[model samples]
Target: MKLSRATGTIATLALAVGLTAACGNGGADAGPAAPVSMDEEITLTFAWWGNDDRAARYEKAIDAFEEKYPNITVQTQFQSWDDYWTARSTEAAGSALPDVVQMDAGYVRQYGATGQLAELDGQVGVNLDTDGVDETALASGQIEGRTYAVPVSLNTQSIIYNATLLEELGMEPPADGYTWDDLVQWFADVAEAGAEHDPQVYPVGDMTGNNPWFLQWLVQQGKAPFTDDGQIAFTEEDVQAWADLWAPLRESQAFFPAKRAAQLEPKTGLNSAEVVAEANWDTLMPNYTAELGSDDLELMPIPTGDDGKKMYWHSGVMLSASASSAHPDAAAAFIDFMTNDPQVGEIFGTSKGVPATDAQKDAMTIEEGSPDARLLAYEDARADDVTEPAPVPVEGYGEIEVEMARLSEEMQYGNLDEDQFASQWFAYVQDTVKAE
Candidate 1:
């Protein structure tokens, strides 16, 4: 979290191949080694993206690790999310990636396909310990046929709301089985009540242009954003239907206007309690609670369709070893410590989202009334409702997300209507996916 900008030249791809030979003894073909010798000295570079709070927690966890394994030392590096990726990309290109790298689902496939990450399964020094972890959650980090990463924690999407504001408005919070119509009505009710207190206050933030939200909506309708083969899956009519659902809210000011919405950050508006509700990842509950300076934050199941809940648990993020790591064995040991160690889980809490392993989850001592407890309870109550997650997005999926945001903003600002937005988005997806 002590973020510093790093600028360096990209390493040549040939350098990557050379580094792999020097560092990759823990590859799939290598036989497992005995427990690390106490006298053996090894050092690893661990990198991740987080804020000051998380960095502090990790620092403590690292100290504990070093105390336990006095022969192994870890050097830590961190940056803001955007800067972390920029640095990682440069390092990856130059065959200078950290021994352990923090990876996101969005980039996992891209990196894995490019041979930038180590194949985790059957690796000599790695103990992924999938026995107590949800198989689907663990599988989230696999790409093609190789296990490239291990989930650090699990998360699911939910409707996070300002519980205090809803209570102040004399409204009961939404229930678990809330439908899409129920959500729309709730938004309207909040917008109507909010006008009396602050004319500019809206029921929700500007999320009309968000790809994840749209993707969830599509999933609820029994459609997918992209097919298993990585082509656009939803029809043009499906996109229009989604747009039409929000058109009325935009017109009635139930949501933030385009100009104002674009300016709002995650720590403002809905996240900060200025809006009554927003759709976001459940892992963000603590951040919202901290930002609002109150424990009055609550999460509800996302609105469902006739088929029931389409929500599925996913890896919030993952820890992956670099194929070019000079100390692959040490890197794998560090990953195992992070994922399977109960003490580490206690230190991390829900900072990275809920621990993925059952033992680590049970070991976590979240205060009874805390946001972390509430999230776990929410997840437990809806465990039976989870469905198969959509496929891990393919390469070039980022471009589709950008196009969606742009067209959504166009529709919101009246430059394009629902039909036009849908047509354009469909055409773009068709061209992009087909070309791939």
Candidate 2:
């Protein structure tokens, strides 16, 4: 239902392709009972990144929103994953931005901390219902102890398997009881099956592939990815364990090559999918209907470790507004409507993962219900498991992908042994974090 977008890569290149528009304000005033939107007849702009699936759904909702608010006209612009952010940020710095915009979890903090972002606290977000949203997701967008943006949803990462592929391979999908050895056995089976069909899948996550998989492996073994207070969480043995995990996985030909992966268009990684399974956001399922057709795909939680540990990535965006926006109140209103309003989640559909609100999450349609159920179950299953932010106060916040890209490429090619790869990774962490 989601693409394995290692958080690092997804954040960096995701903003490259340009789909943002010259933005305008909606007439929504926070000053008095006169909501700016109700007082004036005007054109409002909104921006986001997604495929046609998202465009179609969002535009439809916009049309509906306008029909009810005849005085307010909405100008909507969407982009492929690459260009969405650049356009928004550029517009923000330039003082020309949409009234409502899509914001990311990490960017919200950095932007809010720097004063480039707005607070959705005025008339715009005054009516938001924060009940039942995951605190962790909310925290990511909060900076300096102030809320910047509201989350659209909580998207947990999981291994989506091709039911048909497993059936043909004479194998059943991995379940909660399976441990590392069980996964290795499955990999072996995939190798045997690869002789005839596509083997297991990897999202070919960018800089994210650089650490978390191994970190998750460590977590499975009762270790942490980072320290309790933002320091290195494990030792060389942890690195060795990681090397043991992914290097062999690459050696066994368990994943895809970087070339084949790099050529994939952003927001389109899952389009060419043929392998058995890959990591992705839960929200994309309903939105990317064209890619993942009805009943052809099934979602499953990532397998547990031998120690019964599971980990997740909260791949949701923590939205914040531009501090310079003249209509901060109006922007805040839209934020509340988007995250708290059930229809907005239904409109966005899995574009940014599952809705963060309980009311909206509970109102999922039958088609949306099954996958949402799987997502909630996965969240519950790994509620205690650890998860780390892929990006932090590092220097090369954008280049972590390049580092990961190199390692992932080498691993896929089997150019280095597992231990060698891990050693290389640990060294990279050392050199990279220091530089950051």
Candidate 3:
């Protein structure tokens, strides 16, 4: 499952359409005509994947959009992350897809290549404001040099830690610019401290099966995880070394056991305070703070490489229009409102990630001492050290993500040794990319 969930804040633009303010009232003097009026009333089905909390936020945004464009009624369909892709794939096969759909980078190429998604650029009756949007983030939504989607927000990887727990154990928190060796030693020390404090509290949460963590490590080693043409970039030896790096930590109980980690929700172990630290996206910091019921959580840059570059990327959820939609204009209008409107940003406020546009970011008022503020501050501090994002993954990349998790788990549980796991994983990746 794509673990990226909706969370973030931004500002809103003034309503551009000249529709009547008597939106929901069936009255004679309802309002003026919409800026871009349709010949007939049209209904569009907008779909997305998220939890209940995200659904509520989206509902509010959709309601506002409906009020602005009375002739365009949007029917919403949302589901949990696991069920979303299954339904979408099915819909695609039948040429039946929602008009506006929430998208992720991992699946964009796959969907776009199949002609299931509409090209946003040069599309009739669609006007997207690209003026102040982050170019890097906007570029992530493109395939073969044509825009197929618009990024809703931006996020990057970070190591979130329990500052309260570290202080309780009489350990200073790791500082920015910390090295991989520094992190390893700190985890080892935390494990040792557990004996005197609470042995049940491990130093780090389990990330042995996490693809993003593995990808970051590969980037830190100065290797692209995949080539521009979508070939596997690392060698079997590289995979073995990565597996070996975690072996000692697993043996020493520095990380939660594989079984226990698997049982927990993705990225929740740190929020629950079960482990002192975990690798996660910076966008999720707000969720962690809320779940933990404390403000002591802090975001740190992921460990850097020998060249001192932090291997970071612009990551977040995106929205796209379907090629088969009867209401392409309305779909594009809704996407424009969602991405460029300040009111939507105010309502969402870091639930999706940081706002992707400069206007929205400036208009946002992150509360003092809030998780959103902390995340934004961390980004500001590390702006210079951040590297260019990796190229968008190819069509079969989603399959590789699943394979990575399976292989990593096998290595963790002793089902496969380092060399065996490396060989197997490499071969599987080669086959997957080649098939694409």
Candidate 4:
């Protein structure tokens, strides 16, 4: 069921549209999408969250898009993750979001339900061709039977390790079918093996503070984080259980110290070589390899649970058009080009993530022993392991995730115990979700 919200957050747009129970053609009568005229020239504003490398890739893609459609011009801008949200939220308040924007699955429901995003189903057959896309990946962009965004790529959580470190310690990588207890023992082994090294090499980075990993843990336990209607399905006890899972690592100093982690701003144990392993998205292997200046990194899914391992395919990145934009058709056409163009696949490679469409995937040239090849090989081997459906984050999910991270940081600092963390997080969820 679609929900109506009365919160004053940017998602509501201050226009009192209140949250229309549905966002796309399935819920609201927003009329048909505006038609584009090939004869007339149009300019579109596009924005995204990323570093310079991603910006450069988007630039190339946009250039190709404009070359194909001479009448359409795209002006682009980008920012770091936090800044991107801040700027977009400000723009959302005035109903002035860019014509085209990079979207996160967590924020899609909030923006779509508030009338800030266009209903994309109207453009599907006309301007967008999804025939080459994965059905599961495409479905991830919909909520309440409405399509508000299009997934550009898909990814899943993985534990990436520095093979070089393992080699230096004369240790072998964790074998397949390793359980969570085995992983903890592995951390202890790494610590003991590297005890006499110049700079102490820890076993793993702290993943306890990451919201997505927590959700992944819940899913692995056969617990869905949210209901189909976008309400919280996990309870406070669930949160506590997640916290407890990592207590031994925290107590035994198996992970990189939180202080040291903070000192290495914008860098992580996997990237900086400060620790042997870290749990993150599989798509980040390239970045980690680049940062570590080594090609000896490896990746695998998180350790197994009682019933065996479970994971969900995630829409790593997505695109959405602003409902208030003057050039809806042009916006959608560009999105379609990005989604279906083989050249886009080549230009982006797996930098943005593994492409969501077969055409794009076919376009990639995965050289042997390359990071791209390894990432693809890993996914292919574990495709069947993804047994759960992708999550549809509830309204205010972005804010809730941020709060989760904050409380986790406090817990890391010894300011909040597991009980306090659960209580505070549930309280924040109540106010935030209730307000929405």
Candidate 5:
């Protein structure tokens, strides 16, 4: 049976440490990992950030793990994206973090460099196995040379669309090799065709403030997004260019209305069916399916840029253990089971994204014509398009992106123009991304 506990508020003192605070030689020292073992009874605390569906999936997988190794019991808890980080930062201050955490690439540098996360390389052959995993995807969990986490799945940027709406309008998804200009024109076409519908549909959401898309755009133009020392590498001119790219859509109001979008809190345009298409990760198909109450959503490759197809496969999410865990052996063993087990792939399917290892991919039984099958096929079709290594974000990267998102919403609400948005964003970056 699964073990769980009620979530509680972290100490107010711990909250002052903020999300960027590093543990100062606390009990959770980063060194000398424990050897793998399951000889004695042990209980581990596991935490992740997600909705009810994801919680259920983890419970099912943990049930299998517990069945095999009855000696180890995992007590679990979870929170939303913002709350998860808040709690983690507080726990880090007290060196009381859960044994295992679901890590995001943006905060890996902050956690790993601060010694909050355990290096898993020592436990690889003994307990954790790396066989059949993609080298680049695995490397994303590392900083410099030490392995701090393991990627659970891989994802790439995709233009997700309402296939049912497109078919009803007799419209087609963007073709392969479609350019940025082509995408803009297609948006106009979609807006026109979808006008006569009962609920009314728009082309897409305005993603000009999206930081990842900005990085992709820079790479497509043969520019590096960050320096070796983790400082901002793009210019204010670059930011303005990105903002200007969507000027026509903003002017014509082709995007879903900002006021209307605000009402659909905790959901996106695609989730609420407010728009026909959106730029998002490929793994979101199942979530969209559940939200819209339809299995008609589909994924298409991101629009090609002037420099050709230069998209990179992102480590969608990762599993990492706390350095302070009393039961490191049990922690690593559970992580191994989650990452490499074929049964886990069947249980999770593409809800977390495509499995990161060949073993997990091969083990999953893809039902014909289902979202799981299409998700795998989508990744398989993009093998040649993944050219660059996934970008490892710098410390405070989370704050930077969150600020960008806030400013983008202001821009959409007519509080700031493109030039003002670029100016204010660069100013914030100056104060945010600093040397430690």
Candidate 6:
């Protein structure tokens, strides 16, 4: 709702819309006329996806952004995850993207490469400071050498396990140097323990789990998804190596069966019946625990290789500017004000992972005692994984991930022998990566 200029300067409460955006020439086609300077009054439409909780929180964060900066007003849009991407990609294609939208790291290459985003290199934000934010995570927005967005949060990779399950099994957690063989044995032991007690909960993985699903495995050493260039990195052997970890699990009854594993692979949300533990990014651990209806989940380092090298991949959620934005500097400034600012961090809390800055972590209401506040465990788990470099080709990026999955699936289901899969995976990856 538009507010009278007389009601000017009031705090903009997130949900309450404490004040209207300071737009001028309201009937103009542009919605809000561009201002001459950062101090000039303007209103921008900002969109994002989330459920009721995220919607409410984002509204408040927007309110906080507006209230703190009188000259700038932000109108907010919220939706579920599916709708969020649909609206973003569709509208962006039509030149109708909201002035500022939340950009996930995975899509940085996709959208940023299409010139649908703005460059965020060196931009400042309230809650985010590029310093403590893992450079690897922050770098997810870089395509070639140009930066397209800023990762507002610093989430890393690791495996999330069931602490209670460990306790029940009379087992200690996987130590830092544990290998695939160690995990195989561990799962067998857990399964036996579960049978001794409750007949239902298996020591093996729950049938429907996804994520922590694909990432850092022994196969990782065979070949990467993409190589030195922006092309595909693995051969069939690489694929088999990825599958090898789960292969034993399936054979020894340590993980879900073939059909069950397939059902759990593409999950965007976490819940029970998925798996007792799923290897995934460290940033997601807290959220997974919160979603699982219990705090039994805990963080564990990714298993190491015989050489003692542990591997993991890092992806950043970043903010990018639309190459088409006329107010590029101001857009850059807005990126700076929001993500780099501590107050903005307070408003965001762990909603996006850990705040991008240490100051925000200090001011956060998510106390150390809270399950959601367990940042230290995440910090420790990520201490060892080798962070892969981040870059992407101009197109065909989507195919790489899909092919990676396909090759992995073949290995998991025995369509390809481990040796053959590794050979093919490495060959394909070397070819694709070198081409890119």
Quick one: best TM-score, which candidate? 5
* Candidate 4 lDDT by residue in tens digits, 248-289: 877776777788888898888668887888888899998789
Candidate number that wins on TM-score, 3 or 6: 3
- After superposition, candidate 6 runs with Cα above 4 Å error: 1-36, 122-132, 203-215, 218-224, 227-229, 257-275, 305-316, 384-436
Model 2: per-residue Cα lDDT over 250-284, one tens digit each:
55555555566667755343445545555565555
lDDT of 1 by residue, 52-103 (tens): 8988888888888888778877767778988788878777676567778888
Q: What would the per-residue lDDT of candidate 5 be over residues 227-256, giving only the tens digit for each residue?
A: 645677888898899899888888888888
What stretches of model 2 exceed 4 Å from their correct place? Answer: 1-45, 63-74, 92-99, 120-125, 193-240, 254-274, 283-294, 305-313, 368-398, 414-436
- Let me know the TM-score candidate 1 reaches against the reference structure: 0.87
Candidate 3 lDDT tens digits, 1-436: 1122232211100010101111322111222213346556766667788888888888788778777777777766677777788878777775556667899988877887678887777542345666666566666777767788888888888888888888888887676678877778778898788657764677876465577777778877777776554457788788778777776787776776678776886646677777888788888878888888989798878776457575565648799987766556667788888888887887787788888775667668787878888988987777776665645677888888898788877767868866787788878878887887
lDDT of every predicted structure (CA atoms): 0.74, 0.55, 0.72, 0.79, 0.79, 0.56
Number of the candidate with higher lDDT, 2 or 6: 6
**Pairs that clash in candidate 5:** none
Estimated TM-score per prediction?
Answer: 0.87, 0.71, 0.84, 0.87, 0.88, 0.75
**Order of candidate numbers by TM-score, starting with the best:** 5, 4, 1, 3, 6, 2
Per-residue lDDT of model 6, residues 1-436, tens digit only: 3332211111222212212212211111223323225466565656665677866666666666666666766656666766677666666555545556677766676677666775554343422235656566565667766677776766655667777766765777767678767877776776666656553345444221122334345234543444333444434544554556555565655554456655665542234534456656666776766667787877776666575354533543456555545444455556666666677777777776776657666667776656665655566455556555443332444445555556656655767755665566556555554464
**Residue 287 in candidate 1, Cα distance off native in Å:** 1.3
What lDDT does candidate 5 reach at residue 154? Answer: 89
Lowest lDDT sum, 10 consecutive residues, model 6, at 6-15
Instruction: List candidate 5 segments past 4 Å from native.
Output: 1-35, 168-170, 195-199, 305-307
**Pairs clashing within candidate 1:** 11-94
Q: Candidate 5: minimum summed lDDT over ten consecutive residues — where?
A: 17-26
Candidate 6 local accuracy as lDDT? 0.56
Decide which is better by lDDT, 5 or 6. 5
TM-score of 6: 0.75
